[model samples]
Target chain A: MDVVLQQLRHTYAAPGLEARTVLMIDEWQATSGAQILLRGISGSGKTTLLNILAGLLPPTTGLVRCGGQSLYALPEDERDRLRATTIGYIFQMHHLAPTLSALENVEMPLVFGRKLNAGARRARAYELLDSVGLRDFHRHRPLQLSTGQRLRVAVARALAAQPALVLADEPTAALDAESSHAVMDLLQESCRRTGATLIVASHDPALATRFDRVVDLRNGALHEAETL
Target chain B: MYELKLAWRNLANRPVQTWVTLTVVALAVALAVTVIHLNEGLQRGIIRASDPFGVLVVGAQGSSQQLVLSTLLLQGLPVGNIDGHIFEELRDDPRVALAVPMAMGDNIGGARIVGTDEHFFDLRSSQQAAPAFQLAEGRIFAADFEAVLGSRAAVGLGLRIGDQFRPAHGVEPGLEGDEHAEVHTVVGILQPSGTPFDNAVLTTVNSVIAMHAEALAAPDASTTTDHAAGNDHAAADLVSAAETVSAAETVSAAETVSAAETVSAAETVSAAETVSAAETVSAAEAAHADDHAGDDSHAHASAGQVTAVLVAPVGFIEANQLWRDFYTGAEAQAVFPGRELGGLFDLLNQGQEILILVGYLAAVMAALTLFLAIYSATESRQHLLAILRGVGARRRTVMLVVLVETVLVAMLGALVGRLLGYGAAAAIAGEISRRSAIPVAIGWLPQVEPALWLLPLALGVLAGLLPAWQAYRVNVVEKLFPS
Candidate 1:
């Protein structure tokens, strides 16, 4: 079965600023395990499109079907609950609670998880931190860790709940060249191992080669679609 | 939980501010507590002082207040004598259990000298029904010439039993010589009764009589000595005249003196006559010098026609009849001691109430100062509150934390304040009472009724609620928000 999207469009307006309609994706169909990339330069509505798909924001006009449920059809709290449990987001700037350690940061998703035992939550958090290759740094807070280490911790936290789709927004933007390659490699390897679909929105050419297909947006509209 | 944790940390964070507020609250609460106790004690003391002597009596035309002052307080402008004959008559009555005649006026070293018979000691009483004057070392007066000293008088004058001290005959104290009378032996010293009588020197009825008699008679040897000392060379001339003149020649010279000299002497005589008629200067002087003398017999008789009597009937029925009879007969008034005391208390109670109200107001203002201190801390600790909220603490839990912390601080302040207040009162009570002449009593750690704690507790609750409410209103969502 395919997670479906048909005739998707969105309009955004800022006071005393011109309004714009974003033609995100029209009649797109993709299988559950298919990976996609949204390629865009700055201000091309990449994050905006991700927000709509994740149910963080409502679409002006759209029908999005995921696991046989309409994303926009539920109330705000229900939509939030669905997004929290079923979708994983990795933003450009990873927001880890400064007071909590690396392992605790990875445990964030499980905190909202259903009646899971403390042992289970702790074990999952440990497993994710280890998978992100920061097993020894589990007790270090975000400020104490390197930039790459913090991003890796954020990626581990995102996938801790085992969501079906992982949407990353420039996850390697803050890293050096070598750290960026390593983070992309870990993201692709982890997504492939879990069989979870990965969609990355980035201007970095390195990420284009990591994903199967890339779709580029120009001037709030789709300009090109390509299979790498 | 959230609020208490926040409150405790908040208070800890600003230790100086918390301490200052706590101190202010403590001091005020302590003051309030001490004042409340003192006022209550003073009221009780005054009431006790009032009822020591029973059934105070005065003239028919006199006010109850005047009667209280004249017969009991031994003060105020004096009225004409209530008749020594009537006094004698009253003493002779079969129904009369005890009669003590009080004659006042002369002051010795500024201390009042009361002249009365030995019955004055018998009639003397205390609020607790204890003997008002107990012999500390020796016996009461054995003869009319003997004297008894009050406790303070004995202590202040440095006199003991058997020590002789002269009783002055004039309104002025320390009037020495035969004009004043020789020092009488202090045969007895009365125990401290905490009454005005503590300062008085008790002499027999005769001593008072001798004092006034000296006033009417020629000047004696001591007065002559003092006058001689005061007039050095001038006195020697008088001594020579006394040596040279025969009794017959002196009499002839007195008869031939100038008309102006006679006129001036007549003026002095007229002034003396007016002075004697006022009764306080003369009779009080008489009463004070020798209390037992019969020289006031003529004056008492002349004043008897206008005087009224006080009769203490045996039972309630007789008492009621006496009141009715006095009111209806001869346009006289009879006042019950109990009712009069109540009226006096009622009048004085208003002033006492004002005093208490001011104290309460001061306490409230002090409490506000404490409240402000706590509130100021709450405002400064907003970030700390946010941190606590970010934890698993609930709003009510945070409120309780603030509540508990404030209550604890307030309680501490109250305890400290009370200790300070007690110490302050103890240190200065004597000077205050002596200077004011209002007769304040000093006691260490004066009794504080258990119920008084309610005031501090109430203040604590109020001071706590303000800070607790502030902590409760801390918005968790806003704290998590960037702005």
Candidate 2:
């Protein structure tokens, strides 16, 4: 789905402590099925902006509109439904549920989305696991898999529901150079095949050539960057 | 559906903690359910034991509970035997439908030698069609020294048809010098009644009375001939006639076994009657008529000495009339076995109720344990819960997962508790049967199951709420990528 952000702001609050503004944006938008890369250093609110776009965290000011619906303007349940069907999130770390197997981890979104029954869910999960080339290790738990393999399982999970927008935050942050390139290739290839709007947030400037547009976040403000 | 599957996988992964919580809940429920089933089955078994005793039991003037316990349930020594004529009086009473006398006090190898008439075997009371007791083999005892053993008594004492055993003076076995010299042959074996009576040894009432009279005369006699002559000359005549020509041996040793073997010449002449046992309308009447011929030395034998009388009046009004009349008398008291026994058991039921409350408290503790289990586990899974929320699972879905996990634990515990309850109840019933020598069976009391099952599940639901609330409020962005 196409995404729009208009004058959004959010602050972090803690008890008996300090409140800090973490994210502020005048406007940002990603066209439908476009591949975009967002680059930022640590504490630059890369995760907070993704959270707003995913309908997870409502910003303190302004609205994030996805598929012509202002996410925060709708009820919390409706926002949750939109997140299940339209937006897919990949965290900084490969956060597969430790108890679930690789295939089950891929099936998580489809299970909660309730768009398919058990048989269809398993078929889709098997297809995703096969595409990631971890079909043989699909029954393996998170603790049994190598870091690269777990990240691959997480990628398959993000696209399990065939969501319109795929947001990947530091999908290869903890990987070595070769493993990072391989994981990025697999993630980009899967998104391209599914025609999903891909937004990858990372501080890796070397990844600028992999996207159609590249932007950098510094001091909670967006900056256009020249593609490498 | 997705939420429950997730919850189940989560719990299944933590097998040790899940099993520990389930066992705690099961133990609490098992303890409580055993007490409940025990109390219910014991009371029901006790009541069922008394069903054959007719409407009212009249015995000596002492404890009415003891009278019922001893005469109806055959549990202990009677308060004291009422006058034998009282049984005779009740038998001929116009208001009485049936009056069978019970003479207890003697035992054969730990089995009570119940001195009663043929009517004791099969009571034709209005309660049911089938007789309470039936002869499994041989025939009912008629002449003195002929006895019928109960099913358990035959096996426990290792006696069969035509086998002989002497009666001990008291109700318990293993009393030295208390056994009668009279060797009563087992003429029959009764079918198991599943009551205390399954271990009884039944003989004629007159035989019991005559045996005791003969025992009473033995200490006073100067010689063996005098011992037999002083009680009843017919006894001496019969003992000598037996020794001289293998005549019927008269063994008047124990007080309750007085006339068990005191067969006179007339008894020898009626040996054909003893075999067929058809000559006697009831065994007691035949023994009285044939053995003692107008002998004044053994006045007790002629009059009879009975343990108790089972009285069933013609109607409800007649029952109350007979009960009141018996109550007015100073000699004995009449008790409706159920009402008298119910009052005693109600006190025990109150104790069971307290145990049920303790069971509920245990269930609450089990629920709290579940809460702690989920709460502490959720603390570590905040990251995981955030991921689930990030993957499009609603806050309510997360809450529901916790609820489903806890409730499933409770339901499984209840299922296991019910089986444990039955096992514990059977164990208790077995112990009671072993100690009392009575076959006590387990019974299901109505309206008692839901307490065993539903309460734990409800408590599980209640306990899951706080931990579920914790999961529901998890911050997706904060937990997923913690700073």
Candidate 3:
């Protein structure tokens, strides 16, 4: 699925201050199976743009079309269903349910989809866990795994339903250099295997060199750079 | 199903909070159910004890309330006995359908010995009802010393047919010298009537007179001996002949006996004519002596005095007339047992209403506890709920999960509380049965009260509303990505 943003804009209002635009993107697009990097410092609206692309946050002015469907124009529940079936998101903190095991967390999306029986869901979850090199630790809870392992489990969970678009916001922000590289390699390799459009939001500029395209957010504006 | 599974898993994760909330709900439900059971059971017991036929109790001039209480509830002291002639007057009156005389003030092994006649067994409080007394075993008292035990009395005293027991002179058991020397034999056992009658031992009025003969005898030696010798011979002859003769015939026969000759030949009589002559002279002397005996000794062997009379009028107008007649009479006071019982319940209803109020307060407390448990759970699981929403659960699903969790807890508490209520009522009923003659009926099921379960369920659902709304309004973006 292709992602298209047409003159997208978002604004936030303070209690006593004027409303300020947080994001303004003019005609940015990414093709399917493309690995794109969104790079920005803190408060630069890189996360904001990723949220809009995920259909999580609505744009104040403009249209967000993912796979030719107007994301914001659909009802809230339909958009949620679209996100669940078509988009898999990875947060900066690896928001896996603390109570559920690694395998169970990966199976959570399948529960909401109602497309797989319990046996099929478990089999798919185990396959995802094996793909992420954490098959032996599938039964372990989030707290029982190391930082890199937890992030890997989150990545496997994000791609559990074989979504068309995979969004990772600062996926390796809290990891050491070696762990970060390993997590990024696994995430990108999984996305390539699934033929999913990969969009990674991060402040690290060096990581942008590995992507097919780099969209930089500076001064609330989008700048597209050629793939390395 | 998934929502229930998730809710269960969430509650399981916080064991202490879950158990504390459950215990609070259980305790509140138990307390409320107990109060309701007690109030309802007491009301039912009192009403069952009340006679619907409207019996007018005529006793010696005294507290009519006390008279009714003693006669109907079998509680309190008996007001002084009225003239036995009052019973005959009521029996012969055209307005009176049945007039049964009662002679109380005696007990055998904690069971009250009610001195009445055979007519008492066949009598019913109303024309539409069956006989009030039904035998579970054996038959009614046919002889003076034969007794009919109530169902509970037979069980309590461990007496069966032909078992003889001496009764104490008063209503209480275990008086050192109050027991009568004459032993009465049990002839029958009555079925459970769920009334004070279940704890009574019934006998003929002649048995009461025979038992209290020594006390009722005159101070003069000749009069005492004449009555005793006459009663002994007639009783002996009646026992040997198996004759169902009236007390008047026995008295007339006893008056004809010469005191000296009857006493001398009482155990040595070999000829039937000599025995018949001795019985006649004894009967003539007894009647002559009874005429000389003053009213001071109202416990006379003859039917001259009685504890009270149970009078049933022919109609409402006749009943009112009888009541007016007895009310204005200088010798006795009359009371409607049903009305007196109603007044008694009216006094008890005030306390019952207070108990019901307390029960309501417990239900409210239970609701508050449920609310707190769910609210705190929702507050702590906001992130988890937000994750669920992010995973594609709708707002309605999340809300339903919370509601289901609350309702499950309430259903469990209500069931447990209902069981506890029944247990408490049974224990109380057991204690009451031991202390009093009245047998309180313990219900097997709480069918008498639906609020025992329904109120708790409603409260639980009501308590879940706020928490469910909170879950419905949870912001996935804000909760999952807190700044």
Candidate 4:
């Protein structure tokens, strides 16, 4: 699946200030199985662009097309179904259900899709957890696992549905250097094995150097950087 | 199915809050159901016990309530006696199916001694009904001085067939020499009728008259002394003297004086003529004694008085006529126990409605508790619910999960509460029976009560609404980002 954006623009309304444009992109595209890094400072619209591409937020004025279908042209529920089967999002905070075990948290995305029974869901969740090298920690909850281990579980969950696109917003932001590198490696390796297009939003230049492509968001415009 | 599992997991996550809410609901349901059961049971038991006696007529000399209580309930002071001829008139009437005459004044071991005849055993409330009295052992009294004990009377007094006991002059159990010198033997024991009759000792009307006659003939000194005070020697001396004169002679003398006073004043006779009349009564008494060997009706000389008459009319029309006839007469007052019971229940209905109102208020409080618990839980789980939405759960699914949790708790509370209600009802019924000797069975199942099943469910749905709506509208972006 290929992602396309055509003059995408988004705005936010404040109580007293005039409406402010948060994001503006002119003609940016990425093909399937491509690992792209989005680098930007705070308020640079790095997360906003990722949200638009995932169909989680519609652009205020412009078009977003993932695969061949226009993402914003569909109904809200249809977009949700599309996201469930086609896109997996990893948040900065991991956001694992505190009460669920590691294996159950990884099984969450599969519960929303069809063609998986209880046994099959468990089996697929186990396979994903093994891929992340957290198979022995399946019974541990999010609070019991280290930050790196928690992010690894999140990566496993993001790939559980075998989505075409994997979106990560600062997934390794709270991890130490060694743990951050290890998490990044696991995420990249999982995406490669599944042939999923990976887009990670972060400010870390050291992490950006490992991706196939890196784009910088500055002053509401996209800038292409040299690939590693 | 997954939504239900999630709801269960969420509830299980907070054990204390969940259990406290469940206990509140269960207590409310139990109280409401117990009130309903007890009210229904008391009404039913009273109606069953009151249905067997069609009407009662007592002497017009005293309170009607007292008469009905004494004659039908075997509980109050005996009203003054009416003419025994009233019993004959009711028995001979074509509209009257059966009439049992009662003469109640004495007691044996705290149990009422009811003076009635053999027809009393065969009497029924209506023409189509069967006899109410059935013997549990032995036979009905066939001769004067013989007694038949009711179920409770036999149990309470611990008397069996061939057991002899004397009656006290009044209704109280212990009055020393107030007990008549002549002893009456128990002949039979009646089955439990669940009526006032269950606590009465039955004998021929003659036995009542003979006992009173003996009590009146004895000197006043011995009558005041307590029989339990070791006065056996004095009581023996008096019994020997009374036996020498015979109970028939004493009863006959009392009746002759009563008879002579009824004669016209213009036909007044001399003292010598009274003595001659007394001699003639003595001869008649000897012949009556000889005839008593074969006859079961003893002491017929005292057939002039009775305490009350239990009249069974053919139907409502006959009953009304009897009521009017006796009401107008100067001798006795007639009453319908069913009508009186209806009036009593009418007075009770107001209290019952207030009780039910309180029950409903408690149910409302339970609903409030449920609403608060769910609302608070939703507030704490906003992030978790937002994550669920982010994972592709629809708004409808989130709302359904909350609703299902509320309903499950309500269902569990109702189920357990119904059992507790039944247990409470049984306990109350047992207490009622123990105190009043009136058997009250626990009423029908709680499921039979619509309020018991539907109130909790309706409240659960109503209480779940706000929280469910809140869950439905949770914003995944705001909760996830918060920036």
lDDT of all the models against the reference? 0.59, 0.74, 0.72, 0.74
The complex in candidate 3 yields a DockQ of: 0.47
The list of candidate 1 runs beyond 4 A from truth reads: A1-228, B1-16, B23-35, B59-61, B73-81, B124-130, B167-182, B212-313, B321-334, B420-451, B476-483
Pick by TM-score: 2 or 4, better one: 2
> In angstroms, how far off is B241's CA in candidate 1?
36
Each candidate structure's TM-score, on Cα atoms with residue i matched to residue i, is 0.54, 0.87, 0.76, 0.77
Provide DockQ values for all models, in the order shown: 0.05, 0.71, 0.47, 0.43
Error of 3 at B163 (Å): 3.3
* Candidate achieving the largest DockQ: 2
* lDDT by residue for model 2 (A36-97), tens: 99988988999888888888888989878888788888888777776677788887787899
Q: Candidate 1 residues A19-51, lDDT tens each?
A: 888655677655676677788888788877776
Q: Candidate 4 vs. truth: CA RMSD?
A: 9.2
lDDT of 4 by residue, A39-117 (tens): 9998898878877777767789998888878999998777777666788988888889887889988988788765489
Candidate 3, B364-480: lDDT as tens digits: 887888899989999999998888777667788889889988887787777777777777876786676667655566664447467666777788889999999999999887898
Fnat of candidates, each listed: 0.00, 0.74, 0.43, 0.34
For candidate 3, the TM-score is 0.76
Alpha-carbon runs more than 4 Å astray in model 3: A9-22, A37-46, A59-62, A98-157, A170-195, A202-211, A214-228, B50-55, B60-66, B125-130, B143-145, B168-182, B206-304, B313-321, B327-330, B442-454
Give the chain A TM-score for each candidate: 0.91, 0.95, 0.94, 0.94
**Stretches of candidate 2 exceeding 4 Å from the true structure:** A15-18, B125-128, B168-170, B173-180, B206-302, B437-439, B444-446
Give candidate 3's error at residue B120 in angstroms.
Answer: 2.4
Candidate 1 residue B328 Cα shift, in angstroms, is: 5.1
TM-score: which candidate is best? 2
Scanning candidate 1 chain B in windows of ten residues, the lowest lDDT window is B232-241
lDDT of 2 by residue, B1-483 (tens): 777788888889889988998888788778877888888778877877677778999887878888888887778656666666787778778998887777764677778777777667656335555777888999987565578888888999999887766676545565465565455778899887767888888876655544444444353323232224432222222222223321122232232233334432223424243322311222333454444333221222224456688888888998899889888989888888878798869887999889988887887788888888878877777888888888888999988888888888888888888789879999989898765655667766559777666788787888788888988999887797678
